[model samples]
Target: MDKDTKRDLHSLPKTLAELVGKHIVAAGLLVDEDPERAYKHAAYARRKASRLPTVREASGIAAYTVGKWQEALSDLRAARRMSGRDTFLAIMADCERGLGRPERALEITNDPAAKDLDADERIELRIVAAGARRDMGDVKAALAELQVPELKERRARPYVARLFYAYADVLEELGRKEDAREYFARASSVDREGVTDADERLAAIEGVELVDSDVEDGVVWTDVEEEADEAAAEAEATASRERRDDKGRDHRRDDRRDDRRGGREDRG
Candidate 1:
């Protein structure tokens, strides 16, 4: 429950406010772990508090997380109208792209407020707009769209790694392997939170096989190989547990059958 959400619920009756707040909190908590469940919770909250812009915003985000592109776009549009804020224009454009409407995505980017977005939101808009360009098979235009001054910055902001990663990915798509590799390394250097898989991209570019190791100096050391091995081990353990449970059930059945036979013999 953020301050904005609290303010939205301020006008509601106490009982309705509590219920909507619980649902919104549940949706927020589950959005990362189980997005489908998160969407359900957000939907419930929206149903209860349909007039609240914050509720619509939460539902829109939850819908996006679950890939319900049309629903997300609709909810986000409603949120924008109610709140008179265009903060989610990037997400709206992304939802249009998700629905396979690259032209519509481009159209959304033309909105006047799109230029007024904060730096991070502007970067996200550029990324999505670039993606839409790529979707339209104009890879050159896509490459051009991502060329911004922020890409040249050596200082690490949360969005910088992502920008570098996007640039690297596009370069790879254009068969500029050397340039792509350089940008990937740059992205990896600045990615303190492991937000992008820049390290994995770098490994692929250099043909470096990765293994499981402890994180050193903020670098994530895990690899797909280790993840595969863990998945296999878990599957084997599950099968073993099932086999033991089956065997135990069989043993109990045998004991019951023997006890019945002994009773019959005693009766005879």
Candidate 2:
């Protein structure tokens, strides 16, 4: 847990705090790989301490990962009300979009609390806002919404790559193919950590298709373990063949020796 979350759990009895912390840790560890299980862990923590903002925030994230949009919105609302933090502004808006309420998402993006968010959060909100506009079929408005000074940022922050990607997508929607490709290239250049699909998008614009070689021809990808097992099977088969050959040669030699011994006895 971070210091801020530890501070949030300070009000609980030590034993209760430890239990909640364990569940939170488990939820975090599983959220990306096993979202349903992660949500269950967060739900367990929430049942124990529903009033804590930290628990509610964790539950919100887990719920979001599992596409439980309404539940995610409820948890995030409770967390914000409890802590008065605007940290989840972008995610709350996204949950609104996920719930098929793009207008509500736009409303969240326009919320007065948006001003208090850090640079990264603010940019994420803009991205969600653009998505909401696109969802509402106002593609031009979506394009306009992404036209911010931060779009020109030279610094390679996570949000900068995302912003460039969002802008490129909007430009593509507006039929500005060249402009879209340019921004996609910019996004790919700054996305050193593969946080976005900007590289693939740029490749697509250049008439290139990016494919995973292992997934070609509808074949399932195999791991190193399967390859190793195949190698071991081949080695065992070679050894077994050698053993059979040696046994066959030894039996033939023994028969020849027996035949020679019979001939000598007959001659005597």
Score candidate 2 by lDDT.
0.91
The residue-by-residue lDDT of candidate 1 on 1-268, one tens digit each, is 8999999999899999999999999999999999999999999999899899999999999999999999999999999999999999989999999999999998897788978889889888889989999999999999898999899978777789999999999999999999999999999889887789998889898766556656665344445677788899999999999999999999999999999999999999
Error of 1 at 65 (Å): 0.6
lDDT of 2 by residue, 199-256 (tens): 7788778765455665544223344455688899999999999999999999999999
TM-scores of the candidates are: 0.80, 0.77
* Count of residue pairs whose backbone atoms collide, per candidate: 0, 0
- In order, candidate lDDTs are 0.92, 0.91
What stretches of model 2 exceed 4 Å from their correct place?
209-268
Which predicted model would earn the best TM-score? 1
Q: Which stretches in model 1 have alpha-carbon errors above 4 Å?
A: 218-268
